[model samples]
Target: MKGIPMRINVLQHTPNEGPGMIQDWSDKNGYEMFIYHPYQFGYLPTADETDMLVILGGPMSPNDDLPWIKQERELIQELLNQDKPIFGVCYGAQQIVKTMGYQVTKSPAKEVGFAPVYRRDVKFLNIPEELNVLHWHEEMFEVPEQAQLLFSSDKVENQGFILNHRVVGLQFHLEPKEDNVREIVVNDFPYIKGSVLNQTSEEILQTKISDDNKQTLYKLLDYIIEK
Candidate 1:
């Protein structure tokens, strides 16, 4: 690991919602990791300092009237312009789409808990066609122009998308850990209203451990880094 470059930065939007499995992957792989919390810390890092940028999931919507939302969007645009490797999850995905000139809106059906994502016909850098992934978001993002659609759910068509292979946005929680899912269910359950909130904690536990999904996520990460 001496010659290996280790420069990975994870932009965390919320304290409770930091990188879950991604952190583990990075640590085990000897990649140096840094967390930039724009919400509480009020400091944003320059895109040039980071090799890869991972925007983690959060409870707030991208359309929310928060100053940090705009700041984050601007940083996303800058990163996109630099053609840096970027990965986004849930709200982070929405922000990526919004930064690329697409709109993020509330989905017709609130997608909470585990959901199945059908692989699209389009081939990613080397991603699989179908996989079940963890989902816990009320909002979904519109596919931006020139972005390749990756995965889709029955409720939400735009579950995952790729922008020129390097930039990927996923609506599902590919990096969700057991405790992360449980914490979201316990603390963020009240915010999830309607039928989406009907699922019990037991049901959530069952869905988070889909081995197939975790394998697919590893494939994705490998592809992203290699590409």
Candidate 2:
């Protein structure tokens, strides 16, 4: 590990979908954090300014014709060339897959609540066989040509993937606190359609946030940074 504190750069797409426990993790680890709202203003950190890069989830699709979206893709590519540790969630994951020359398509069914993900036998990542995580995404990415599929859920086959062991992308969320969950639930509740895969607002609201998920997120962050 480097003796100096790492400078973590976060690309936040929306106000509601900000990094929850990620901020907590950075604070606890004494890492310097700098978050930028690229959707509002297209100011992303360069590779030199970032020791680690975190891309948070959002409601927008990676295929959308937004300027910041395109910029983010280019930035991901640039960071990959420099071998920076990059972590992405949901739409952010899609962005990474898109940057890797893959398509981000709609899943057979939407996952909108706490769902279980079965871990694959990946040596680099030490995740549990089964974990109930928060999911609120409709579009999903495939495991790229040279990437390892990390987690898969019943509804979504490609729940998570890791590229070159340094770039980690997760479809399900394990970083949201209760308030962060509530914010997304309240802001995007109208889009939730009640189905076997999609949970009702009440069910999501009633389900307490798990501490294990937070710990897993912290572990994943540490793993990515140290790799």
Each model's number of backbone clashes? 1, 0
* Clashing residue pairs for model 2: none
Q: Write the per-residue lDDT of candidate 1 for residues 172-216, one digit (tens) a residue.
A: 888877888777777776655564546666677666466666677
- Candidate 1: regions farther than 4 A off: 1-4, 124-128, 196-198
TM-score (C-alpha, index-matched) for candidate 1:
0.91
Candidate 2, residues 1-227, lDDT tens digits: the string is 75888999999988889889999999998999999998887798887888999999988999999988888888899999988899999998999999989999988787788878988878555667788888988889978989888899987889988777588899989889888989988988887885456578888888887677887788788877775
Task: State TM-scores per candidate.
Answer: 0.91, 0.94
Question: Which window of 10 residues has the lowest lDDT sum in candidate 2?
Answer: 190-199
RMSD of each: 2.0, 1.9
